[model samples]
Target chain A: MSAVEKASRPRVAIVNFGMGNLFSVRQACLRAGLEPSITSKKAELLEADGVILPGVGAFGRAMETLREQGLVSVLKDLAAAGRPFMGICLGLQLLFDESIEFGRHEGMAIFAGQVVRLEPGIGPAGRPLKIPEIGWKPLRPPSGRGWDGSLLEGLPEGAHMYFVHSFHALAAKSESVLAITPFGDMNYCAAVQQGRLFACQFHPERSGPVGLKVYENFRKMILSGR
Target chain B: MAAVRFIARLDVKGPNLVKGVHLEGLRVLGKPEDFARHYYENGIDELIFMDVVASLYGRNSLLDIIRKTSSEIFIPLSVGGGLRSIEDIRAVLAAGADKVCLNTAAIANPELVREASRCFGSSTIVVSIEAIRQPDGSYEAYTDNGRQKTGVEAVGWARRAAELGAGEIMITSVDREGTGQGYDLALTKSVASAVDIPVIACGGAGRKEHVGDAVTQGWANAVGVASLLHYNVLDVVGGTGSYEEEGNIEYLKGRRGFSHVERSSLGEIKEYLRGLGLECR
Candidate 1:
């Protein structure tokens, strides 16, 4: 709670639009040596040196809550301002232009993409692939790309991170795709980076040490003012 | 296949972390938070804290423990035992549990699984089925920590739960639990094959090979281990914090170990799994 008052450290606002637990996100920030404030106020989010949009819930419900809180435009403006902005899990889905979950829903349109469910299919090993790919999966860089200047800089290739979700983002602009994770017979866009905005479909806060490095990278980005 | 998840499951009785054989006669080990932190520091993929006495006592007391753990350890945390309603599930998720495992409530009211999954996404809801083998070679679902039988077939219940909207299924064998005889491979394979959702095999993992066997042979997507990891770290992570309750101080005081359960660290288990070419985080 006192983390927000520390003016000497870089401030990171964890956007709370009534999704789910923000404590783990805040804790991860503190461990990363960044001051995190869990707030919904527009002024607090706009004033932070960096912002993290973390969520866990349905895509429709989360977008509805953000619209109700009048935070849809606030998020768009934060992305426009080019601050170190990030999203996790459902937060990553909300960055897309629209989501086909439950029903057709509009996202913040930060990126040109659509959120879609992981269709049930067959695994390469001749087993039925499960929906809601809920476990640890290694992240692979897109073709001809690697984690050099992105938030995943220090992480080794194929570093496993915890993921728990049923839907994933399909960016229309393939160049924005930072990482892809293999599940069953297909690979999904697991992380993306565009300008100052970085988002991932995995919960780094719940992913232990390999995950903590992600926060550390975010902190470094904030400190460098990049 | 994705990397197999290795979860450290700690059963809690009152304020102290407890372990039992066949889910009964729970002996207090230490504070749940202590064990949770230790596991987190040691690279556990996930953590499950089940309030073992919550259903019998009609109350859940894992919120504070979860709040404390979530503030430090960064890993997926699943909580079970005594979650009977949407509000109960919501309260725990709000308190920092990423997923809520429903057993007694899901069986008594199958609609609860649908309602909860609808309210809080299917991935957030996990249906925990505690199974005990019967005379006819069928696994029967038991409630209240294996103290009450629901007369429902375990494999059938797992399929029904998934159909009703459970994103994951955790099948724990009451017979193999705490006995260190290895997991009930038959029970685990039956439920895993019955549902397309991820299945976590729990109970009776006494060796690293057992952990490997659960995935390679039993077809489990994950494994929930207790004594194999808990008894191995008590000496390093010491805590009897704020537990004035009776029967909570004897086990740690004596430093006695389990003969049935083998001592192994989380790192060792993962290493052993990797040696088998089984991908584990």
Candidate 2:
């Protein structure tokens, strides 16, 4: 823990658009052996060895805050430049073309998809499934795709993840959909991987030991410089 | 259907984690973080830390505990008790609490539920409803950890809180709490059926069968267990590591166990629930 050693560690910039708490994300990064900084400055974001977009809240409000902070294009360029990017929860929604939450709002458009609210459906017991889908769910790889060599590498097939959101993304292209999770009667995109950009609709930082592997993987990806 | 969340509830008084029958006459168990880490490692779905004496002191003292656990534990951490204002909520969230449970403040000013939800997303706001069943079979809302009674109806308050944008509701039965008998199924069902948001049933889980009843009969989306899990850990941990200058330490020093409530670990509870064909992580 010398200052020199601390500076030598990989820098992970967590985009702070002033929407939600970033403490858990920052703590997860440190536990994963990465030096994390919560910054919105374009230069700080671009200079980091890895970047994480962690958020919670309404999609339209988050986008508005990002735009107001002048971080819209900055995020797009970072994902476009392939800077080991990862998004969690609402951050995953902001990577799409647009979201219909609280009216249609533009997104960072790094991926081709539209975020829509989860359809209300009834559970097996005849009770209506709760909105926001607040609970732990296991991840299933999409057909023709695997977790191997991806952001979810080394994770088990049915690894449970913590999710808390009312809306999910609809990937236009099938190849972009990395994982799909089943609700009452619908299946929605849980995670997406296109080139260097990666995003998941679950909070890995809040998902426990199994979820911590995700941050560990991101740290390894940064150190490997791939 | 998604898996049912099995959460461990820890009632903290000063620096010690304590448990009491009817949320009174608390007996110090041990350190809060130790039990939290143990539960997290054992695959507990979530952890809730309630400051049992925060209302009496007029401030939440769980900030340090929350910060310490947020670094070591990698799961959702929710802190409650004496969160009166927006700044208090912000302070706890910034200290690494994923959600804040509001009871006294929300009951005093119902608008806090709406305002806090709007300010910090609905998902971050959880309305804690403590209820005591009346002679007429209607449940009344109680504040200050079931010490003060409000004339408001329990089920009606739940509907109102959800309408005010609360993403989740945690209904704790003051009568059933710490009794180790079972959850007040009537109280939970009425509230759960009233709101579309998730409702977590708290208190009165003596055995794994009680947990099953809470989900199957009570219709609880999640269960907040304290005595069953806490006593189980205490049996293994045996004696408090350090005597903190707060709360009652005599219970821990004597190593006297609670014979009334059956003890079970988080793993055993999840296994029993899964055996009954209920999905659990």
Candidate 3:
């Protein structure tokens, strides 16, 4: 296949470490018009055009699986090398320095931040709201830096996506933050971009057409260059 | 600031989407996947698939239905009914289901909620309750298709389930199910207030305003509808009339409540809710 055509059908390695529903992620990848191979194998990650670190459940257990499956170094290398990467929910949490959930679990430290619990009970409306913040929430309007022009390229300024998480990422540096979403007491970093590396505390696959649009834009980014 | 989720609940029996009033009467609709597509295209926020008769023999059909729906429908899907063990929950997730709603199993062993939540994250474990009202103005949680009472009061049990790590509590009012008398607002509000997790209010929605009431008055994070959507299937007289896929054509042939149902379109409902100042996509 020609380089352009080959780039158009980029293969993404969905990192699976005994956490998350890999099938749904794989399905989302396919919906984004990309080939997805759910694998824990090191060689698969090396061959793909991009990598997706999808995760759920406890941070400690997930870190254990990642270490045991021999993926920690590979992920760290990708982060340092600035490869196209995306993390969802717990995957996004795992990208930070540490998390307070189930004790202090050290993350990949790919970005500088700590994951902390959201303020529970009262929401912005002053009415009592549930934690774990389920359902669809709108992303705060992007900063002046905005998106990198591919991943969020045609997406509305304040597009909403499905989110289901108690803990959120807190960027140590404001410059690393790409998007902020409000939750009751305050607004936190909902999405961050470190060069080609992008991570979000929301599930793009579950966010309906807008979510699918996110994947489509990411797919275009992967196809734009060598 | 999350938009309230508008869910379409489809109950399956064997290979067909079945509808009943107050969780009874047994009316066949169409194929679950086809119905799911209709709602997905119409801008539904989420979907819930409950296998009305979830025995070991009937699981294959449900899995097939889910696998098909997940491929085309790119929204969050919560599947329930006959999920008993951690393996069963895993199997549902393996079939591309985003979340699993546990009613009978979670009730039998409350630890199952803890275990499943631990394995598949609390967000993926939704504790579903079929609440039947009592004479003394209390609601009892029922299992086995609401045939047997678990004696657990709706709000209290919902709190306990959330404490045990259940991510969401889906309370369906058996008393108001298919009754079109508007949601059991009192029951929904109580459970919603009791849990620290999201509460999904199901049943008793014959009007568009009832859905709005569930969010405003009932404090539900999401609203689940069945007869209002399934009974009022879109394009029954015009499109999706070919291939005779599964038993949908036959069911549609004998379809009831095509135009008689008092349900509004998904767009209309979202527009109405947004007009009411509720955030909706």
RMSD for each of the candidates: 2.6, 1.8, 2.5
Clashing pairs in 3: A136-B2, A137-B2
Worst 10 residues of 1 chain B by lDDT: B53-62
- Residue-level lDDT of model 2, residues B51-92, one tens digit each, is 888842323358888888888998888999889999999988
Q: Comparing 2 and 3 by TM-score, which wins? A: 2
Interface RMSD against the true structure, candidate 2? 1.0
Off by over 4 Å in 2: A1-8, B55-60
- How high is the CA lDDT of each candidate model? 0.87, 0.88, 0.83
- lDDT tens readout by residue for model 3, B45-76: 89999988885335457888888899888889
How do the candidates rank by DockQ, highest first?
2, 3, 1
Top model number, DockQ: 2
Clashes of 2: 0
List TM-score per model, in order.
0.93, 0.97, 0.94
Residue runs of model 1 more than 4 Å from their true location after superposition = A1-7, B55-60, B238-244, B248-253
Provide the lowest-lDDT 10-residue window in model 2 chain B: B53-62
The better candidate by lDDT, 1 or 2, is: 2
lDDT of 3 by residue, A26-139 (tens): 887887789899899999998888999988888889999999999999988976776788888899999999999878989999888899987676753454678878888787
